[model samples]
Target: MAKFTDHDDYIAAAPEQFRPLLGQLRSRLAEVLPDADELIVYDMPGFGFGKSIIAGYAAFSKQCGLYVSNAAITAHADEIVAAGLKFTKTGLTFSPRHPIPDELVTKLALASRRELGV
Candidate 1:
Protein backbone atom coordinates (compact mmCIF):
# COMPACT_ATOMS: atom_id res chain seq x y z
CA MET A 1 0.00 0.00 0.00
CA ALA A 2 1.16 3.52 -0.68
CA LYS A 3 1.59 6.04 2.14
CA PHE A 4 -0.43 9.11 1.25
CA THR A 5 0.43 12.53 2.66
CA ASP A 6 -3.02 13.96 1.92
CA HIS A 7 -6.18 13.60 -0.15
CA ASP A 8 -4.46 14.83 -3.29
CA ASP A 9 -1.68 12.33 -2.84
CA TYR A 10 -4.11 9.52 -2.23
CA ILE A 11 -6.13 10.36 -5.30
CA ALA A 12 -3.01 10.73 -7.40
CA ALA A 13 -1.80 7.32 -6.26
CA ALA A 14 -5.01 5.56 -7.17
CA PRO A 15 -5.41 3.65 -10.43
CA GLU A 16 -6.11 5.81 -13.43
CA GLN A 17 -9.65 4.63 -13.96
CA PHE A 18 -10.72 5.54 -10.46
CA ARG A 19 -9.29 9.03 -10.26
CA PRO A 20 -12.31 10.85 -11.62
CA LEU A 21 -14.74 8.90 -9.48
CA LEU A 22 -12.67 9.58 -6.40
CA GLY A 23 -12.51 13.24 -7.32
CA GLN A 24 -16.25 13.45 -7.69
CA LEU A 25 -16.84 11.79 -4.35
CA ARG A 26 -14.39 14.12 -2.66
CA SER A 27 -16.07 17.18 -4.16
CA ARG A 28 -19.57 16.09 -3.23
CA LEU A 29 -18.56 15.32 0.33
CA ALA A 30 -16.81 18.64 0.60
CA GLU A 31 -19.84 20.47 -0.68
CA VAL A 32 -22.10 18.84 1.90
CA LEU A 33 -19.63 19.22 4.76
CA PRO A 34 -18.07 22.57 4.08
CA ASP A 35 -17.47 23.20 7.78
CA ALA A 36 -15.84 19.83 8.32
CA ASP A 37 -12.11 19.51 8.39
CA GLU A 38 -10.28 17.57 5.70
CA LEU A 39 -8.62 14.56 7.21
CA ILE A 40 -6.38 11.65 6.42
CA VAL A 41 -6.88 8.66 8.70
CA TYR A 42 -5.85 5.05 8.20
CA ASP A 43 -4.44 6.35 4.91
CA MET A 44 -7.92 7.25 3.67
CA PRO A 45 -9.35 10.70 2.99
CA GLY A 46 -12.11 11.89 5.31
CA PHE A 47 -14.02 14.90 6.56
CA GLY A 48 -13.96 15.54 10.26
CA PHE A 49 -16.34 17.47 12.45
CA GLY A 50 -15.71 17.80 16.15
CA LYS A 51 -13.58 14.80 17.15
CA SER A 52 -15.23 12.33 14.82
CA ILE A 53 -14.77 11.75 11.11
CA ILE A 54 -18.12 12.51 9.56
CA ALA A 55 -17.28 10.93 6.20
CA GLY A 56 -14.44 9.17 4.44
CA TYR A 57 -13.74 7.85 0.95
CA ALA A 58 -11.30 5.51 -0.72
CA ALA A 59 -10.46 3.95 -4.05
CA PHE A 60 -9.52 0.34 -3.92
CA SER A 61 -8.36 -1.90 -6.76
CA LYS A 62 -11.85 -2.86 -7.80
CA GLN A 63 -14.12 -0.27 -6.22
CA CYS A 64 -14.46 3.07 -4.53
CA GLY A 65 -16.05 3.58 -1.15
CA LEU A 66 -17.92 6.24 0.74
CA TYR A 67 -17.71 5.67 4.47
CA VAL A 68 -19.95 7.34 7.00
CA SER A 69 -21.41 6.40 10.36
CA ASN A 70 -23.25 3.13 10.80
CA ALA A 71 -26.46 4.99 11.43
CA ALA A 72 -26.12 6.70 8.08
CA ILE A 73 -25.67 3.39 6.36
CA THR A 74 -28.71 1.94 8.05
CA ALA A 75 -30.77 4.97 7.25
CA HIS A 76 -29.98 4.74 3.56
CA ALA A 77 -29.65 1.02 3.03
CA ASP A 78 -32.73 0.90 0.88
CA GLU A 79 -31.52 3.63 -1.41
CA ILE A 80 -28.18 1.93 -1.72
CA VAL A 81 -29.85 -1.32 -2.65
CA ALA A 82 -32.19 0.45 -4.98
CA ALA A 83 -29.25 2.00 -6.74
CA GLY A 84 -27.73 -1.47 -7.13
CA LEU A 85 -24.78 -0.57 -4.96
CA LYS A 86 -23.24 -2.66 -2.21
CA PHE A 87 -22.55 -1.51 1.32
CA THR A 88 -21.07 -2.60 4.62
CA LYS A 89 -21.92 -1.55 8.12
CA THR A 90 -20.34 1.84 7.73
CA GLY A 91 -19.74 2.36 4.04
CA LEU A 92 -20.97 1.91 0.51
CA THR A 93 -18.89 0.56 -2.37
CA PHE A 94 -19.36 1.29 -6.04
CA SER A 95 -17.45 0.91 -9.24
CA PRO A 96 -17.32 3.35 -12.15
CA ARG A 97 -19.72 1.14 -14.02
CA HIS A 98 -22.19 1.70 -11.19
CA PRO A 99 -21.34 4.92 -9.58
CA ILE A 100 -22.91 6.22 -6.40
CA PRO A 101 -25.55 8.84 -6.98
CA ASP A 102 -24.75 12.42 -5.99
CA GLU A 103 -27.96 12.80 -4.03
CA LEU A 104 -27.21 9.69 -2.04
CA VAL A 105 -23.81 11.04 -1.17
CA THR A 106 -25.37 14.24 0.15
CA LYS A 107 -27.93 12.33 2.16
CA LEU A 108 -25.32 10.07 3.70
CA ALA A 109 -23.04 12.95 4.61
CA LEU A 110 -25.85 14.95 6.16
CA ALA A 111 -27.14 11.92 8.01
CA SER A 112 -23.68 11.18 9.34
CA ARG A 113 -23.23 14.75 10.52
CA ARG A 114 -26.55 14.67 12.32
CA GLU A 115 -26.08 11.22 13.82
CA LEU A 116 -22.60 12.01 15.08
CA GLY A 117 -23.89 15.24 16.63
CA VAL A 118 -21.20 17.18 14.82
Candidate 2:
Protein backbone atom coordinates (compact mmCIF):
# COMPACT_ATOMS: atom_id res chain seq x y z
CA MET A 1 0.00 0.00 0.00
CA ALA A 2 1.16 3.53 -0.68
CA LYS A 3 1.99 5.79 2.25
CA PHE A 4 -0.69 8.45 2.71
CA THR A 5 0.00 11.73 4.43
CA ASP A 6 -3.71 12.50 4.76
CA HIS A 7 -7.23 11.65 3.60
CA ASP A 8 -6.81 13.47 0.32
CA ASP A 9 -3.60 11.63 -0.43
CA TYR A 10 -5.20 8.30 0.42
CA ILE A 11 -8.30 8.98 -1.68
CA ALA A 12 -6.22 10.29 -4.59
CA ALA A 13 -4.03 7.19 -4.53
CA ALA A 14 -7.03 4.83 -4.45
CA PRO A 15 -8.21 2.95 -7.51
CA GLU A 16 -10.11 5.09 -9.98
CA GLN A 17 -13.30 3.12 -9.53
CA PHE A 18 -13.30 3.66 -5.77
CA ARG A 19 -12.43 7.33 -5.56
CA PRO A 20 -16.02 8.57 -5.71
CA LEU A 21 -17.11 6.04 -3.13
CA LEU A 22 -14.30 7.10 -0.85
CA GLY A 23 -15.24 10.73 -1.32
CA GLN A 24 -18.88 10.07 -0.48
CA LEU A 25 -17.94 8.18 2.65
CA ARG A 26 -15.62 10.96 3.72
CA SER A 27 -18.34 13.53 3.28
CA ARG A 28 -20.87 11.53 5.23
CA LEU A 29 -18.48 10.95 8.10
CA ALA A 30 -17.49 14.57 8.21
CA GLU A 31 -21.12 15.69 8.19
CA VAL A 32 -22.04 13.48 11.11
CA LEU A 33 -18.93 14.12 13.17
CA PRO A 34 -18.28 17.77 12.68
CA ASP A 35 -16.31 18.15 15.90
CA ALA A 36 -14.13 15.08 15.48
CA ASP A 37 -10.60 15.62 14.32
CA GLU A 38 -9.72 14.08 10.99
CA LEU A 39 -6.59 11.97 11.08
CA ILE A 40 -4.90 8.91 9.69
CA VAL A 41 -4.90 5.88 11.93
CA TYR A 42 -3.53 2.45 11.16
CA ASP A 43 -2.84 3.65 7.63
CA MET A 44 -6.47 4.61 6.99
CA PRO A 45 -8.39 7.87 7.21
CA GLY A 46 -10.19 8.13 10.56
CA PHE A 47 -12.16 10.51 12.75
CA GLY A 48 -10.59 11.00 16.14
CA PHE A 49 -12.71 11.80 19.20
CA GLY A 50 -11.75 11.92 22.84
CA LYS A 51 -8.32 10.51 22.18
CA SER A 52 -9.74 7.58 20.22
CA ILE A 53 -10.11 6.95 16.54
CA ILE A 54 -13.85 6.33 16.51
CA ALA A 55 -14.29 5.85 12.82
CA GLY A 56 -12.14 5.02 9.81
CA TYR A 57 -12.37 4.09 6.14
CA ALA A 58 -10.24 2.54 3.42
CA ALA A 59 -10.39 1.42 -0.20
CA PHE A 60 -9.14 -1.95 -1.32
CA SER A 61 -8.69 -3.68 -4.68
CA LYS A 62 -12.39 -4.41 -5.26
CA GLN A 63 -14.21 -2.69 -2.40
CA CYS A 64 -14.20 0.04 0.22
CA GLY A 65 -14.74 -0.30 3.94
CA LEU A 66 -16.25 1.84 6.70
CA TYR A 67 -14.96 1.01 10.13
CA VAL A 68 -16.43 2.01 13.47
CA SER A 69 -16.53 0.74 16.99
CA ASN A 70 -17.58 -2.88 17.44
CA ALA A 71 -20.49 -1.66 19.52
CA ALA A 72 -21.82 0.19 16.52
CA ILE A 73 -21.45 -2.87 14.36
CA THR A 74 -23.28 -5.09 16.78
CA ALA A 75 -26.04 -2.56 17.25
CA HIS A 76 -26.63 -2.35 13.53
CA ALA A 77 -25.95 -5.91 12.47
CA ASP A 78 -29.56 -6.58 11.53
CA GLU A 79 -29.80 -3.57 9.31
CA ILE A 80 -26.49 -4.38 7.71
CA VAL A 81 -27.60 -7.91 6.87
CA ALA A 82 -30.90 -6.63 5.56
CA ALA A 83 -29.04 -4.32 3.25
CA GLY A 84 -27.27 -7.32 1.74
CA LEU A 85 -23.88 -6.09 2.90
CA LYS A 86 -21.04 -7.97 4.50
CA PHE A 87 -19.27 -6.85 7.64
CA THR A 88 -16.73 -7.84 10.22
CA LYS A 89 -16.82 -6.92 13.87
CA THR A 90 -15.86 -3.36 13.09
CA GLY A 91 -15.95 -2.86 9.34
CA LEU A 92 -18.57 -2.81 6.61
CA THR A 93 -17.32 -3.62 3.10
CA PHE A 94 -19.06 -2.41 -0.02
CA SER A 95 -18.47 -1.84 -3.71
CA PRO A 96 -19.94 0.50 -6.31
CA ARG A 97 -22.55 -2.02 -7.32
CA HIS A 98 -23.58 -2.47 -3.68
CA PRO A 99 -22.78 0.78 -2.04
CA ILE A 100 -23.59 1.38 1.60
CA PRO A 101 -26.34 3.92 2.11
CA ASP A 102 -25.50 7.41 3.33
CA GLU A 103 -28.05 7.08 6.14
CA LEU A 104 -26.33 3.99 7.46
CA VAL A 105 -23.00 5.74 7.40
CA THR A 106 -24.45 8.57 9.43
CA LYS A 107 -25.85 6.20 12.00
CA LEU A 108 -22.61 4.31 12.37
CA ALA A 109 -20.57 7.48 12.70
CA LEU A 110 -22.90 8.88 15.33
CA ALA A 111 -22.87 5.64 17.22
CA SER A 112 -19.09 5.61 17.18
CA ARG A 113 -18.96 9.15 18.48
CA ARG A 114 -21.42 8.29 21.22
CA GLU A 115 -19.28 5.32 22.20
CA LEU A 116 -16.31 7.61 22.56
CA GLY A 117 -18.33 9.87 24.89
CA VAL A 118 -17.41 12.90 22.86
Q: Point to the candidate with the largest TM-score.
A: 1
TM-score of each: 0.96, 0.94
RMSD of each: 1.0, 1.2
- For residues 8-40, write the lDDT of model 2, one tens digit per residue: 999999999999999988988888888888898
Instruction: Tell me the lDDT of candidate 1.
Output: 0.92
The local distance difference test score of each candidate is: 0.92, 0.88
Model 1 segments more than 4 A misplaced: none
Instruction: Report the C-alpha displacement of residue 107, candidate 1, in angstroms.
Output: 0.3
Q: What is the Cα-based lDDT of residue 81 in candidate 2?
A: 88
